[model samples]
Target: MLSVVIPLYNEARTIVRVLEAVQEAPLPTGIGREVVVVDDGSADGSADVVAAYAASNPALGVRLLRHAHNQGKGAALHTGIAAASGDYIVVQDADLEYDPTDYAKLLQPVLKANADVVYGSRFIGGEPHRILFFWHSIGNKLLTFLSNAFNDLNLTDMETGAKLFRRELLQGLMLREKRFGFEPEVTAKMARIPGVRVYEVGVSYYGRTYAEGKKINWRDGLWALWCIVRYGLFS
Candidate 1:
């Protein structure tokens, strides 16, 4: 089964479309599906969207988790992971950047082959071109390069919000980073674990400008750098 963990905060503009895409997605034949949306204290009507979806599909097992305040993304995701009930868990964003239709592509390595963790790499071979921020791409590549040096695992996209894993892979991992540090923390620590196989596959990416609610700021780049060192050595 698949437990989709979505971190939401003031995403009312795109949550409904994203949720509907998942609802109509063609999941794997035998695996059941559950979508859990974590509301990171959105004053916007994001929770209402999840409620509406849940109201329509009782059998689909949709759940809404609300935070009293705007906790960081990592905290929201960690909460969702603890509550996830499927054998596999996937991190999905409320924005329409990543396509729900491509979920099967991301799940293939874990379900059919030899990977405990899989990331949808925007820079990989089969991915379609995406309009990107020049500095953002440069920053992402530099951080990923540093992560590769630290973890000794070559990865293309360090901060892609698309990550899938077997629930067992994350056993006992108390995630520390609350925000943008989440990705590097997971990748760094995950690379050190024994018998864990990680892979990256090409996936579609549709980036948005600031006016479109793209919230990652220039300062988050500093946090990513800290995560590469902090999780690699301290953790």
Candidate 2:
């Protein structure tokens, strides 16, 4: 089974749609999926929405966990990961930017090459991508480059939200980031694991604008750079 860990905040406007997509996404034969949604104290009734959805779809294996107050995304993920009982795990954002259909694509390396980790790259695919911020694109590439320089990795999308991991490998890590820094911190630590087989695949990106509820910004990019140095070089 694959556990989809969704670290949700105040995304009440899109959480239900994301849940439906997860429910309907087609997985490879014999691979069952369960959703672990960790609501990080959403003020917009996102937790209530998730509760209602899980109550309505009793057969979907949707498990809802809650934080009493707003912790960051990484903190929420820590909670979700601990509660996951699947053989493999994948992180899913509670937004429309990422399509759940690509879960199949992310699983290919695991089935064929015994990949311990898989990263879905948005920059290398022929799949449809909404043309958006040029600076953000550059920032992603620059961060990837810096991360590669520090960790000796060749990943094209270190900051990508779509990542898959063997449950044991993921739960073994000492992940400390509590916000947007999760991306760089995880990438660095995962790279340091001796003989770990990591893979990357092209995936579609339907990025959103700030008006469409996009939360990341340049400050987060700066923090990611610090994370790369801290985890990649220091720890």
Clashes of each: 0, 0
The alpha-carbon lDDT assigned to residue 49 of candidate 2 equals 97
Local lDDT at 178 for model 2:
92
State the lDDT of candidate 2 residue by residue for 145-190, as single tens digits.
9999999999999999999999998899999999999999989988
The ten-residue window of minimal lDDT in model 2 covers: 121-130
lDDT comparing candidate 1 with the true structure: 0.86
Question: Candidate 1, residues 13-42: lDDT per residue as tens digits?
Answer: 899888888878777778778898999988
User: Model 2, stretches more than 4 Å misplaced?
Assistant: none
Model 2 collision count:
0
Each prediction's TM-score versus the true structure: 0.96, 0.98
